[model samples]
Target chain A: MSDQPTGVPREEYRPSPSDIAPKLADLQVGRTVVTASIPLSRADLVRYAGASGDYNHIHWNERFAREVGLENVITHGMLTMGSVISRIAEWAVDPGAIVDYRTRFTSPVVVPDAESGAPDTPTTSLEMTASVGAVDTEAGIARLDVEVTSGGTKVLGRTQVKVRLS
Target chain B: MAVNTELQGSSYPLAQPFEVTREAIAQFARATGANSRSHFDPESAAQFGYSDVVAPPTFAVIPAQRTEALYITRPDAGIDFARVVHGSEQFTYTRPIVAGDVLAATCHVDGIREAGGHAMITTRTELTTADGDEPVATVVSTIVVRGEDA
Candidate 1:
Protein backbone atom coordinates (compact mmCIF):
# COMPACT_ATOMS: atom_id res chain seq x y z
CA MET A 1 0.00 0.00 0.00
CA SER A 2 1.25 3.46 -0.79
CA ASP A 3 0.62 6.63 1.25
CA GLN A 4 1.04 8.80 -1.81
CA PRO A 5 -2.38 10.13 -2.73
CA THR A 6 -1.38 11.60 -6.11
CA GLY A 7 1.97 9.88 -6.56
CA VAL A 8 3.96 12.78 -5.14
CA PRO A 9 5.99 10.51 -2.77
CA ARG A 10 4.49 11.64 0.53
CA GLU A 11 6.70 11.99 3.64
CA GLU A 12 4.26 11.04 6.47
CA TYR A 13 3.50 7.69 8.16
CA ARG A 14 2.50 6.11 11.52
CA PRO A 15 4.99 4.09 13.54
CA SER A 16 4.75 0.32 13.86
CA PRO A 17 6.27 -1.22 17.03
CA SER A 18 9.08 -2.90 15.06
CA ASP A 19 10.10 0.00 12.85
CA ILE A 20 11.53 3.39 13.94
CA ALA A 21 11.99 4.32 10.28
CA PRO A 22 9.76 7.31 10.18
CA LYS A 23 11.58 9.84 8.64
CA LEU A 24 7.81 8.92 8.51
CA ALA A 25 7.43 9.96 12.10
CA ASP A 26 5.98 13.01 10.38
CA LEU A 27 2.88 13.03 12.52
CA GLN A 28 0.81 16.07 13.50
CA VAL A 29 -1.31 16.65 16.56
CA GLY A 30 -4.97 15.66 16.12
CA ARG A 31 -8.02 16.66 18.03
CA THR A 32 -10.45 14.42 19.94
CA VAL A 33 -13.68 16.30 20.50
CA VAL A 34 -15.35 15.25 23.74
CA THR A 35 -18.02 16.24 26.26
CA ALA A 36 -18.44 14.92 29.81
CA SER A 37 -19.50 16.42 33.12
CA ILE A 38 -16.93 16.17 35.95
CA PRO A 39 -18.44 14.29 38.86
CA LEU A 40 -16.99 15.15 42.31
CA SER A 41 -17.70 13.36 45.55
CA ARG A 42 -16.41 13.67 49.12
CA ALA A 43 -15.26 10.10 49.12
CA ASP A 44 -13.38 10.37 45.84
CA LEU A 45 -11.54 13.35 47.21
CA VAL A 46 -10.71 11.37 50.31
CA ARG A 47 -9.43 8.45 48.29
CA TYR A 48 -7.27 10.70 46.15
CA ALA A 49 -5.97 12.42 49.25
CA GLY A 50 -4.81 9.08 50.58
CA ALA A 51 -3.18 8.12 47.35
CA SER A 52 -1.46 11.45 46.74
CA GLY A 53 -0.78 12.32 50.41
CA ASP A 54 -1.90 15.88 49.77
CA TYR A 55 -3.23 16.90 53.18
CA ASN A 56 -3.97 20.47 52.17
CA HIS A 57 -6.81 22.02 54.18
CA ILE A 58 -8.33 23.48 51.05
CA HIS A 59 -9.26 20.06 49.80
CA TRP A 60 -11.47 18.05 52.19
CA ASN A 61 -12.84 20.31 54.88
CA GLU A 62 -16.01 21.99 53.72
CA ARG A 63 -16.46 24.02 56.86
CA PHE A 64 -12.79 24.91 57.06
CA ALA A 65 -12.97 25.96 53.45
CA ARG A 66 -16.00 28.12 54.13
CA GLU A 67 -14.44 29.58 57.22
CA VAL A 68 -11.59 30.97 55.20
CA GLY A 69 -13.78 31.75 52.14
CA LEU A 70 -14.32 28.67 50.03
CA GLU A 71 -17.54 27.02 48.87
CA ASN A 72 -16.41 23.59 50.01
CA VAL A 73 -13.41 21.42 50.27
CA ILE A 74 -12.72 21.65 46.54
CA THR A 75 -11.06 18.85 44.60
CA HIS A 76 -7.30 18.46 44.48
CA GLY A 77 -5.16 19.99 41.71
CA MET A 78 -3.33 16.78 40.87
CA LEU A 79 -6.58 14.80 40.79
CA THR A 80 -8.08 17.02 38.14
CA MET A 81 -4.78 17.48 36.37
CA GLY A 82 -4.34 13.74 36.42
CA SER A 83 -7.80 13.39 34.93
CA VAL A 84 -6.91 15.90 32.24
CA ILE A 85 -4.08 13.66 31.07
CA SER A 86 -5.34 10.25 32.19
CA ARG A 87 -6.68 9.52 28.71
CA ILE A 88 -3.25 9.96 27.18
CA ALA A 89 -1.74 7.24 29.33
CA GLU A 90 -4.62 5.03 28.28
CA TRP A 91 -3.87 5.71 24.62
CA ALA A 92 -0.08 5.99 24.53
CA VAL A 93 2.38 3.13 24.23
CA ASP A 94 3.61 4.31 27.62
CA PRO A 95 1.27 5.24 30.42
CA GLY A 96 2.90 8.56 31.29
CA ALA A 97 4.80 9.35 28.14
CA ILE A 98 4.46 12.93 26.96
CA VAL A 99 6.75 15.14 24.94
CA ASP A 100 5.29 18.27 26.52
CA TYR A 101 2.04 19.26 28.30
CA ARG A 102 0.61 22.37 30.02
CA THR A 103 -2.53 24.35 31.01
CA ARG A 104 -3.56 27.49 32.81
CA PHE A 105 -5.98 27.43 35.75
CA THR A 106 -8.96 29.53 34.78
CA SER A 107 -11.55 28.33 37.31
CA PRO A 108 -11.99 26.41 40.50
CA VAL A 109 -13.51 22.91 40.40
CA VAL A 110 -16.41 22.63 42.85
CA VAL A 111 -17.77 19.18 43.60
CA PRO A 112 -21.55 18.91 43.33
CA ASP A 113 -23.69 18.43 46.45
CA ALA A 114 -20.94 20.02 48.52
CA GLU A 115 -22.79 23.30 48.73
CA SER A 116 -26.23 22.20 47.58
CA GLY A 117 -26.68 20.47 50.96
CA ALA A 118 -27.75 17.35 49.10
CA PRO A 119 -26.40 13.83 49.21
CA ASP A 120 -22.81 13.46 48.02
CA THR A 121 -22.24 13.01 44.32
CA PRO A 122 -21.68 9.39 43.27
CA THR A 123 -18.17 9.93 41.87
CA THR A 124 -15.03 11.86 42.74
CA SER A 125 -13.36 12.31 39.38
CA LEU A 126 -14.53 15.34 37.45
CA GLU A 127 -16.66 14.06 34.57
CA MET A 128 -14.83 15.89 31.77
CA THR A 129 -15.79 16.28 28.12
CA ALA A 130 -12.57 16.23 26.13
CA SER A 131 -12.17 17.27 22.50
CA VAL A 132 -9.24 17.53 20.16
CA GLY A 133 -8.31 21.20 20.38
CA ALA A 134 -5.49 20.71 17.83
CA VAL A 135 -3.30 18.10 16.20
CA ASP A 136 0.13 17.36 14.73
CA THR A 137 -0.22 13.77 13.53
CA GLU A 138 2.80 14.42 11.36
CA ALA A 139 4.74 15.08 14.58
CA GLY A 140 3.20 12.13 16.45
CA ILE A 141 1.32 14.39 18.85
CA ALA A 142 -2.27 15.42 19.60
CA ARG A 143 -3.76 17.93 21.98
CA LEU A 144 -7.04 17.11 23.72
CA ASP A 145 -9.27 19.81 25.13
CA VAL A 146 -11.15 18.83 28.27
CA GLU A 147 -13.99 20.59 30.06
CA VAL A 148 -15.94 19.22 33.01
CA THR A 149 -19.03 21.14 34.00
CA SER A 150 -22.06 20.88 36.22
CA GLY A 151 -25.09 23.12 36.88
CA GLY A 152 -24.06 25.13 33.83
CA THR A 153 -20.79 26.21 35.44
CA LYS A 154 -17.40 24.99 34.27
CA VAL A 155 -15.75 23.04 37.12
CA LEU A 156 -12.54 22.19 35.32
CA GLY A 157 -11.90 24.64 32.52
CA ARG A 158 -9.01 25.17 30.18
CA THR A 159 -7.73 21.67 30.79
CA GLN A 160 -5.51 20.46 27.92
CA VAL A 161 -3.49 17.33 27.17
CA LYS A 162 -0.59 16.60 24.79
CA VAL A 163 0.26 13.04 23.87
CA ARG A 164 3.13 11.28 22.05
CA LEU A 165 1.70 8.46 19.95
CA SER A 166 3.08 5.02 19.24
CA MET B 1 -4.06 33.68 61.90
CA ALA B 2 -5.25 36.01 59.18
CA VAL B 3 -4.56 35.31 55.50
CA ASN B 4 -3.04 37.84 53.15
CA THR B 5 -5.62 38.93 50.64
CA GLU B 6 -3.47 41.58 49.05
CA LEU B 7 -1.03 39.37 47.19
CA GLN B 8 -0.74 40.37 43.54
CA GLY B 9 1.52 40.20 40.53
CA SER B 10 5.23 39.94 41.45
CA SER B 11 4.19 39.42 45.07
CA TYR B 12 5.56 35.91 44.86
CA PRO B 13 9.03 35.81 46.45
CA LEU B 14 10.83 32.79 45.01
CA ALA B 15 14.53 32.39 44.39
CA GLN B 16 15.17 32.46 40.65
CA PRO B 17 17.52 29.50 39.95
CA PHE B 18 17.23 25.77 40.77
CA GLU B 19 18.50 22.42 39.63
CA VAL B 20 16.94 19.03 38.87
CA THR B 21 18.70 15.69 39.05
CA ARG B 22 17.90 12.51 37.21
CA GLU B 23 17.11 10.85 40.53
CA ALA B 24 14.41 13.36 41.45
CA ILE B 25 12.78 13.08 38.04
CA ALA B 26 13.01 9.31 38.12
CA GLN B 27 11.28 9.36 41.46
CA PHE B 28 8.47 11.54 40.16
CA ALA B 29 8.16 9.35 37.09
CA ARG B 30 7.77 6.36 39.37
CA ALA B 31 5.17 8.08 41.50
CA THR B 32 3.29 9.01 38.35
CA GLY B 33 3.50 5.45 36.97
CA ALA B 34 5.30 6.60 33.81
CA ASN B 35 8.80 5.57 34.74
CA SER B 36 10.61 4.60 31.53
CA ARG B 37 14.23 3.78 30.77
CA SER B 38 14.79 6.97 28.85
CA HIS B 39 13.64 8.90 31.87
CA PHE B 40 15.99 7.13 34.29
CA ASP B 41 18.31 5.16 32.06
CA PRO B 42 21.19 7.40 31.08
CA GLU B 43 22.25 5.08 28.27
CA SER B 44 18.73 4.67 26.93
CA ALA B 45 18.16 8.42 27.22
CA ALA B 46 21.12 9.18 24.97
CA GLN B 47 19.12 7.63 22.14
CA PHE B 48 16.28 10.21 22.35
CA GLY B 49 18.18 13.51 22.09
CA TYR B 50 18.34 13.53 25.86
CA SER B 51 21.34 13.05 28.09
CA ASP B 52 19.10 10.88 30.19
CA VAL B 53 15.62 9.38 29.51
CA VAL B 54 14.46 12.99 30.16
CA ALA B 55 11.65 13.35 32.62
CA PRO B 56 8.06 12.79 31.61
CA PRO B 57 6.22 15.64 29.92
CA THR B 58 4.24 16.21 33.09
CA PHE B 59 7.40 16.36 35.16
CA ALA B 60 6.68 20.01 35.76
CA VAL B 61 5.19 18.92 39.07
CA ILE B 62 8.67 19.11 40.59
CA PRO B 63 9.15 22.77 39.83
CA ALA B 64 5.52 23.32 40.67
CA GLN B 65 6.42 21.91 44.03
CA ARG B 66 8.91 24.71 44.54
CA THR B 67 6.17 27.11 43.56
CA GLU B 68 4.35 26.08 46.70
CA ALA B 69 6.91 28.06 48.64
CA LEU B 70 5.65 31.21 46.98
CA TYR B 71 2.33 30.84 48.82
CA ILE B 72 1.85 30.76 52.53
CA THR B 73 0.32 27.64 54.05
CA ARG B 74 -1.59 29.16 56.92
CA PRO B 75 -4.35 28.24 59.36
CA ASP B 76 -6.71 30.78 57.82
CA ALA B 77 -6.28 29.00 54.52
CA GLY B 78 -9.47 27.14 55.60
CA ILE B 79 -7.76 23.93 54.76
CA ASP B 80 -8.35 21.15 57.24
CA PHE B 81 -5.23 19.05 57.28
CA ALA B 82 -7.67 16.23 57.79
CA ARG B 83 -10.17 17.27 55.11
CA VAL B 84 -8.47 19.44 52.49
CA VAL B 85 -9.31 18.70 48.87
CA HIS B 86 -7.12 18.59 45.77
CA GLY B 87 -8.30 21.09 43.20
CA SER B 88 -6.69 21.22 39.78
CA GLU B 89 -3.28 21.92 38.21
CA GLN B 90 -2.14 22.54 34.62
CA PHE B 91 1.40 22.45 33.17
CA THR B 92 2.51 23.90 29.81
CA TYR B 93 6.00 23.47 28.46
CA THR B 94 7.47 26.30 26.44
CA ARG B 95 10.54 24.19 25.78
CA PRO B 96 11.60 20.64 26.50
CA ILE B 97 12.85 20.06 30.10
CA VAL B 98 15.39 17.44 30.89
CA ALA B 99 17.16 15.94 33.87
CA GLY B 100 20.42 17.57 35.04
CA ASP B 101 19.11 20.87 33.77
CA VAL B 102 19.38 23.84 36.09
CA LEU B 103 16.20 25.90 35.90
CA ALA B 104 14.99 29.29 37.07
CA ALA B 105 11.34 29.70 38.00
CA THR B 106 9.50 32.98 38.39
CA CYS B 107 6.03 32.89 39.92
CA HIS B 108 3.18 35.38 39.91
CA VAL B 109 -0.22 35.56 41.53
CA ASP B 110 -2.53 35.18 38.59
CA GLY B 111 -5.87 35.76 40.35
CA ILE B 112 -7.87 35.56 43.53
CA ARG B 113 -11.57 35.22 44.20
CA GLU B 114 -14.12 34.34 46.83
CA ALA B 115 -16.53 31.48 46.29
CA GLY B 116 -19.10 30.48 48.87
CA GLY B 117 -16.78 31.86 51.54
CA HIS B 118 -13.77 30.01 50.22
CA ALA B 119 -10.65 31.84 49.13
CA MET B 120 -9.65 30.66 45.70
CA ILE B 121 -6.05 31.40 44.80
CA THR B 122 -4.48 30.93 41.39
CA THR B 123 -0.69 30.77 41.19
CA ARG B 124 1.29 30.80 37.96
CA THR B 125 4.96 29.95 37.64
CA GLU B 126 7.15 30.20 34.56
CA LEU B 127 10.19 27.92 34.33
CA THR B 128 13.14 29.21 32.37
CA THR B 129 16.88 28.92 31.98
CA ALA B 130 19.62 31.21 33.35
CA ASP B 131 21.51 31.60 30.12
CA GLY B 132 18.82 32.84 27.68
CA ASP B 133 15.64 33.30 29.75
CA GLU B 134 13.82 31.05 27.31
CA PRO B 135 10.56 29.78 28.78
CA VAL B 136 10.51 26.04 29.29
CA ALA B 137 6.93 25.68 30.55
CA THR B 138 4.22 27.21 32.69
CA VAL B 139 2.15 25.83 35.54
CA VAL B 140 -1.20 27.28 36.55
CA SER B 141 -2.57 25.89 39.78
CA THR B 142 -5.92 26.46 41.49
CA ILE B 143 -6.59 25.74 45.16
CA VAL B 144 -9.99 26.15 46.78
CA VAL B 145 -10.12 26.55 50.54
CA ARG B 146 -13.20 25.40 52.48
CA GLY B 147 -13.21 27.22 55.76
CA GLU B 148 -15.49 27.43 58.75
CA ASP B 149 -18.31 29.99 58.63
CA ALA B 150 -17.55 33.09 60.64
Candidate 2:
Protein backbone atom coordinates (compact mmCIF):
# COMPACT_ATOMS: atom_id res chain seq x y z
CA MET A 1 0.00 0.00 0.00
CA SER A 2 1.07 3.56 -0.69
CA ASP A 3 2.27 5.39 2.42
CA GLN A 4 1.00 8.68 1.08
CA PRO A 5 -0.56 10.71 3.83
CA THR A 6 -4.32 10.98 3.87
CA GLY A 7 -6.18 14.32 3.77
CA VAL A 8 -3.19 16.13 2.31
CA PRO A 9 -2.93 17.41 -1.24
CA ARG A 10 -0.84 15.09 -3.42
CA GLU A 11 1.33 17.90 -4.73
CA GLU A 12 2.95 18.16 -1.33
CA TYR A 13 4.41 14.70 -1.87
CA ARG A 14 5.34 15.04 -5.51
CA PRO A 15 8.50 13.43 -6.89
CA SER A 16 10.59 15.43 -9.32
CA PRO A 17 10.54 14.18 -12.89
CA SER A 18 14.28 13.60 -12.82
CA ASP A 19 13.80 11.20 -9.96
CA ILE A 20 11.12 9.10 -11.60
CA ALA A 21 11.30 9.20 -15.42
CA PRO A 22 13.14 6.30 -16.98
CA LYS A 23 15.92 7.03 -19.43
CA LEU A 24 15.19 5.95 -22.98
CA ALA A 25 18.81 5.03 -23.58
CA ASP A 26 18.61 2.43 -20.82
CA LEU A 27 15.39 0.83 -21.98
CA GLN A 28 15.55 -2.59 -23.64
CA VAL A 29 12.84 -4.33 -25.58
CA GLY A 30 11.15 -7.27 -23.83
CA ARG A 31 12.23 -6.17 -20.38
CA THR A 32 9.62 -6.35 -17.66
CA VAL A 33 9.51 -2.97 -15.97
CA VAL A 34 6.37 -2.60 -13.91
CA THR A 35 4.50 -4.94 -11.58
CA ALA A 36 1.77 -4.09 -9.10
CA SER A 37 -1.27 -5.39 -7.30
CA ILE A 38 -4.20 -3.00 -7.03
CA PRO A 39 -6.89 -3.73 -4.47
CA LEU A 40 -10.55 -2.93 -4.98
CA SER A 41 -13.43 -2.74 -2.56
CA ARG A 42 -17.15 -1.99 -2.79
CA ALA A 43 -16.57 1.58 -1.66
CA ASP A 44 -14.24 2.11 -4.61
CA LEU A 45 -17.03 1.19 -7.03
CA VAL A 46 -19.36 3.80 -5.53
CA ARG A 47 -16.64 6.44 -5.59
CA TYR A 48 -15.80 5.69 -9.23
CA ALA A 49 -19.47 5.86 -10.22
CA GLY A 50 -19.78 9.31 -8.68
CA ALA A 51 -16.57 10.56 -10.25
CA SER A 52 -17.10 9.24 -13.78
CA GLY A 53 -20.85 9.99 -13.89
CA ASP A 54 -21.45 6.33 -14.80
CA TYR A 55 -24.18 5.57 -12.31
CA ASN A 56 -24.80 2.05 -13.57
CA HIS A 57 -26.45 0.16 -10.74
CA ILE A 58 -24.68 -3.04 -11.78
CA HIS A 59 -21.52 -1.54 -10.42
CA TRP A 60 -22.89 -0.80 -6.96
CA ASN A 61 -26.13 -2.66 -6.26
CA GLU A 62 -25.98 -6.42 -5.79
CA ARG A 63 -29.64 -6.90 -6.63
CA PHE A 64 -29.35 -5.00 -9.86
CA ALA A 65 -26.21 -6.93 -10.72
CA ARG A 66 -28.00 -10.22 -10.23
CA GLU A 67 -30.93 -9.07 -12.30
CA VAL A 68 -28.48 -8.32 -15.09
CA GLY A 69 -27.06 -11.89 -14.92
CA LEU A 70 -23.84 -10.91 -13.18
CA GLU A 71 -22.43 -13.07 -10.44
CA ASN A 72 -22.13 -10.04 -8.21
CA VAL A 73 -21.33 -6.36 -8.34
CA ILE A 74 -18.50 -5.70 -10.80
CA THR A 75 -15.91 -2.99 -11.24
CA HIS A 76 -16.44 -0.57 -14.07
CA GLY A 77 -14.21 -1.37 -17.04
CA MET A 78 -13.09 2.23 -17.30
CA LEU A 79 -12.31 2.32 -13.61
CA THR A 80 -10.00 -0.64 -13.96
CA MET A 81 -8.48 0.84 -17.10
CA GLY A 82 -8.00 4.22 -15.50
CA SER A 83 -6.49 2.88 -12.31
CA VAL A 84 -3.75 0.76 -13.93
CA ILE A 85 -2.37 3.55 -16.10
CA SER A 86 -1.32 5.56 -13.08
CA ARG A 87 1.50 3.09 -12.57
CA ILE A 88 2.58 3.64 -16.16
CA ALA A 89 2.44 7.41 -15.66
CA GLU A 90 4.74 7.01 -12.71
CA TRP A 91 7.14 4.89 -14.75
CA ALA A 92 7.21 7.45 -17.54
CA VAL A 93 7.37 10.23 -14.97
CA ASP A 94 4.85 12.36 -16.84
CA PRO A 95 1.20 11.64 -17.40
CA GLY A 96 1.32 13.69 -20.59
CA ALA A 97 3.96 11.46 -22.08
CA ILE A 98 1.43 8.80 -22.93
CA VAL A 99 0.03 9.25 -26.42
CA ASP A 100 -1.88 6.05 -27.09
CA TYR A 101 -3.50 3.29 -25.06
CA ARG A 102 -5.76 0.43 -26.03
CA THR A 103 -7.24 -2.66 -24.48
CA ARG A 104 -9.79 -5.42 -25.04
CA PHE A 105 -12.01 -6.31 -22.12
CA THR A 106 -12.14 -10.08 -22.17
CA SER A 107 -13.60 -10.75 -18.76
CA PRO A 108 -15.46 -8.93 -16.02
CA VAL A 109 -13.88 -8.23 -12.67
CA VAL A 110 -16.43 -9.51 -10.21
CA VAL A 111 -15.85 -7.72 -6.90
CA PRO A 112 -17.52 -9.73 -4.18
CA ASP A 113 -19.25 -8.07 -1.29
CA ALA A 114 -17.62 -7.85 2.07
CA GLU A 115 -17.83 -10.91 4.24
CA SER A 116 -20.10 -10.92 7.25
CA GLY A 117 -17.16 -10.54 9.61
CA ALA A 118 -14.97 -8.01 7.78
CA PRO A 119 -16.85 -5.05 6.36
CA ASP A 120 -13.88 -2.96 5.26
CA THR A 121 -11.64 -5.53 3.64
CA PRO A 122 -10.92 -5.46 -0.05
CA THR A 123 -12.70 -8.14 -2.04
CA THR A 124 -10.05 -8.72 -4.70
CA SER A 125 -7.03 -7.29 -6.45
CA LEU A 126 -5.82 -6.84 -10.01
CA GLU A 127 -2.42 -8.33 -10.63
CA MET A 128 -0.53 -6.54 -13.37
CA THR A 129 2.74 -6.97 -15.26
CA ALA A 130 4.03 -4.65 -17.98
CA SER A 131 6.98 -5.05 -20.31
CA VAL A 132 8.60 -3.11 -23.06
CA GLY A 133 7.33 -4.51 -26.34
CA ALA A 134 9.08 -2.18 -28.73
CA VAL A 135 11.30 0.90 -28.73
CA ASP A 136 11.56 3.50 -31.45
CA THR A 137 14.73 5.46 -30.96
CA GLU A 138 14.23 7.80 -33.90
CA ALA A 139 10.65 8.59 -32.96
CA GLY A 140 11.51 8.76 -29.28
CA ILE A 141 8.65 6.43 -28.44
CA ALA A 142 8.30 3.18 -26.53
CA ARG A 143 5.47 0.69 -26.54
CA LEU A 144 4.55 -1.44 -23.55
CA ASP A 145 2.48 -4.60 -23.48
CA VAL A 146 0.56 -4.80 -20.25
CA GLU A 147 -1.14 -7.91 -18.91
CA VAL A 148 -3.79 -7.42 -16.24
CA THR A 149 -5.47 -10.33 -14.53
CA SER A 150 -7.92 -10.88 -11.72
CA GLY A 151 -8.23 -14.20 -9.89
CA GLY A 152 -5.81 -15.77 -12.39
CA THR A 153 -7.98 -14.89 -15.39
CA LYS A 154 -7.10 -12.24 -17.93
CA VAL A 155 -9.44 -9.26 -17.79
CA LEU A 156 -7.77 -7.00 -20.35
CA GLY A 157 -6.25 -8.40 -23.53
CA ARG A 158 -3.81 -7.09 -26.08
CA THR A 159 -3.28 -4.10 -23.82
CA GLN A 160 -0.76 -1.67 -25.20
CA VAL A 161 0.51 1.75 -24.14
CA LYS A 162 2.67 4.12 -26.16
CA VAL A 163 4.77 6.76 -24.46
CA ARG A 164 6.86 9.59 -25.86
CA LEU A 165 10.29 9.94 -24.35
CA SER A 166 11.71 13.34 -23.47
CA MET B 1 -34.05 -6.56 -29.50
CA ALA B 2 -31.21 -5.87 -31.87
CA VAL B 3 -29.62 -2.43 -32.21
CA ASN B 4 -30.72 -0.41 -35.20
CA THR B 5 -28.34 -1.19 -38.02
CA GLU B 6 -29.40 1.96 -39.85
CA LEU B 7 -27.60 4.11 -37.31
CA GLN B 8 -24.30 2.98 -38.66
CA GLY B 9 -22.18 5.81 -40.05
CA SER B 10 -24.38 8.37 -38.27
CA SER B 11 -22.81 11.09 -36.14
CA TYR B 12 -24.20 12.74 -33.00
CA PRO B 13 -22.71 15.94 -31.68
CA LEU B 14 -22.97 16.76 -28.02
CA ALA B 15 -25.59 19.38 -27.25
CA GLN B 16 -23.65 21.04 -24.44
CA PRO B 17 -20.04 21.98 -23.91
CA PHE B 18 -18.03 20.08 -21.34
CA GLU B 19 -16.11 22.53 -19.21
CA VAL B 20 -13.20 20.79 -17.61
CA THR B 21 -12.54 21.91 -14.06
CA ARG B 22 -9.84 21.40 -11.47
CA GLU B 23 -12.26 19.90 -8.98
CA ALA B 24 -13.45 17.32 -11.44
CA ILE B 25 -9.91 16.37 -12.36
CA ALA B 26 -8.98 16.05 -8.70
CA GLN B 27 -11.99 13.91 -8.00
CA PHE B 28 -11.27 11.58 -10.90
CA ALA B 29 -7.64 11.31 -9.90
CA ARG B 30 -8.57 10.41 -6.36
CA ALA B 31 -11.12 7.85 -7.44
CA THR B 32 -8.61 6.16 -9.74
CA GLY B 33 -5.84 6.36 -7.16
CA ALA B 34 -3.73 8.58 -9.40
CA ASN B 35 -1.46 10.53 -7.09
CA SER B 36 0.32 12.59 -9.71
CA ARG B 37 0.77 16.21 -8.68
CA SER B 38 -0.02 17.48 -12.15
CA HIS B 39 -3.53 16.11 -11.76
CA PHE B 40 -4.14 17.95 -8.50
CA ASP B 41 -2.08 21.16 -8.31
CA PRO B 42 -2.20 23.95 -10.85
CA GLU B 43 1.27 25.07 -9.89
CA SER B 44 2.70 21.65 -10.60
CA ALA B 45 0.86 21.46 -13.87
CA ALA B 46 2.18 24.85 -14.92
CA GLN B 47 5.68 23.65 -14.22
CA PHE B 48 4.97 20.74 -16.51
CA GLY B 49 3.96 23.15 -19.33
CA TYR B 50 0.21 22.81 -18.93
CA SER B 51 -2.15 25.71 -18.47
CA ASP B 52 -3.87 24.17 -15.47
CA VAL B 53 -4.22 20.92 -13.62
CA VAL B 54 -3.69 18.03 -16.01
CA ALA B 55 -6.31 15.32 -16.33
CA PRO B 56 -5.49 11.66 -16.57
CA PRO B 57 -5.62 10.21 -20.09
CA THR B 58 -8.76 8.20 -19.49
CA PHE B 59 -10.72 11.28 -18.43
CA ALA B 60 -11.75 11.76 -22.04
CA VAL B 61 -14.18 8.86 -21.63
CA ILE B 62 -16.43 11.00 -19.47
CA PRO B 63 -17.27 13.35 -22.31
CA ALA B 64 -17.09 10.61 -24.91
CA GLN B 65 -19.74 8.60 -23.10
CA ARG B 66 -21.99 11.64 -22.91
CA THR B 67 -21.68 12.06 -26.65
CA GLU B 68 -22.54 8.39 -27.17
CA ALA B 69 -25.65 8.80 -25.05
CA LEU B 70 -27.22 10.73 -27.88
CA TYR B 71 -27.35 7.50 -29.85
CA ILE B 72 -27.66 4.97 -27.03
CA THR B 73 -30.78 6.60 -25.62
CA ARG B 74 -32.63 6.81 -28.90
CA PRO B 75 -35.64 4.48 -29.09
CA ASP B 76 -34.54 3.19 -32.45
CA ALA B 77 -31.11 2.27 -31.12
CA GLY B 78 -32.66 -0.76 -29.37
CA ILE B 79 -30.06 -0.80 -26.64
CA ASP B 80 -31.02 -2.05 -23.20
CA PHE B 81 -28.52 -0.37 -20.91
CA ALA B 82 -28.66 -3.13 -18.34
CA ARG B 83 -27.57 -5.74 -20.86
CA VAL B 84 -24.73 -3.77 -22.41
CA VAL B 85 -21.15 -4.77 -21.68
CA HIS B 86 -18.02 -2.90 -22.49
CA GLY B 87 -15.96 -4.81 -25.06
CA SER B 88 -12.95 -2.69 -25.91
CA GLU B 89 -11.54 0.83 -25.82
CA GLN B 90 -8.79 2.71 -27.59
CA PHE B 91 -7.59 6.29 -27.17
CA THR B 92 -5.12 8.37 -29.13
CA TYR B 93 -4.35 11.78 -27.67
CA THR B 94 -2.79 14.82 -29.28
CA ARG B 95 -2.10 16.14 -25.84
CA PRO B 96 -3.16 15.56 -22.28
CA ILE B 97 -6.41 17.24 -21.29
CA VAL B 98 -6.05 20.05 -18.77
CA ALA B 99 -8.37 21.94 -16.49
CA GLY B 100 -9.87 25.11 -17.99
CA ASP B 101 -10.34 23.49 -21.39
CA VAL B 102 -13.86 23.77 -22.78
CA LEU B 103 -14.45 20.68 -24.85
CA ALA B 104 -17.09 19.07 -27.07
CA ALA B 105 -17.41 15.64 -28.61
CA THR B 106 -19.10 14.19 -31.66
CA CYS B 107 -19.77 10.48 -31.63
CA HIS B 108 -19.83 8.53 -34.86
CA VAL B 109 -21.40 5.12 -35.06
CA ASP B 110 -18.85 3.25 -37.10
CA GLY B 111 -20.56 -0.12 -37.29
CA ILE B 112 -23.24 -2.36 -35.81
CA ARG B 113 -23.57 -6.07 -36.42
CA GLU B 114 -24.97 -9.22 -34.87
CA ALA B 115 -22.55 -11.99 -33.99
CA GLY B 116 -22.91 -15.11 -31.89
CA GLY B 117 -26.14 -13.99 -30.19
CA HIS B 118 -24.88 -10.49 -29.40
CA ALA B 119 -25.04 -7.06 -31.00
CA MET B 120 -21.64 -5.43 -31.37
CA ILE B 121 -21.60 -1.69 -31.76
CA THR B 122 -18.53 0.41 -32.43
CA THR B 123 -18.37 4.16 -31.85
CA ARG B 124 -15.69 6.75 -32.43
CA THR B 125 -15.78 10.04 -30.58
CA GLU B 126 -13.68 13.04 -31.50
CA LEU B 127 -13.01 15.49 -28.68
CA THR B 128 -11.96 19.03 -29.51
CA THR B 129 -11.71 22.43 -27.94
CA ALA B 130 -15.05 24.20 -27.88
CA ASP B 131 -13.53 27.52 -28.93
CA GLY B 132 -10.63 26.83 -31.31
CA ASP B 133 -11.71 23.37 -32.48
CA GLU B 134 -8.25 22.02 -31.70
CA PRO B 135 -8.21 18.28 -31.70
CA VAL B 136 -7.55 16.80 -28.29
CA ALA B 137 -8.28 13.13 -28.55
CA THR B 138 -10.08 10.39 -30.40
CA VAL B 139 -11.83 7.64 -28.47
CA VAL B 140 -13.01 4.40 -30.06
CA SER B 141 -15.21 2.07 -28.08
CA THR B 142 -17.00 -1.23 -28.66
CA ILE B 143 -19.95 -2.43 -26.63
CA VAL B 144 -21.66 -5.81 -26.71
CA VAL B 145 -25.38 -6.19 -26.05
CA ARG B 146 -26.30 -9.75 -25.16
CA GLY B 147 -29.25 -11.40 -26.89
CA GLU B 148 -32.28 -12.14 -24.71
CA ASP B 149 -32.17 -15.83 -25.34
CA ALA B 150 -28.48 -16.01 -24.64
Residue B82, model 2: lDDT of: 82
**Pairs with steric clashes in candidate 2:** none
**lDDT value for model 2:** 0.87
Worst 10 contiguous positions by lDDT, candidate 1 chain A = A1-10
Evaluated at residue A156, the lDDT of candidate 1 is: 53
- Clashes (backbone N, CA, C under 3 Å), per candidate, total 67, 0
**C-alpha TM-scores of all predictions:** 0.59, 0.95
- Candidate 2 lDDT tens digits, A24-78: 7789998999998888878778888999999989999999899888899999999
- What i-RMS does each candidate reach, in Å? 9.7, 2.2
Query: What is the DockQ score, from 0 to 1, of model 1?
Result: 0.15
Docking class of 2: medium
lDDT of 2 at B60: 91
lDDT (C-alpha, whole model) for all candidates: 0.55, 0.87
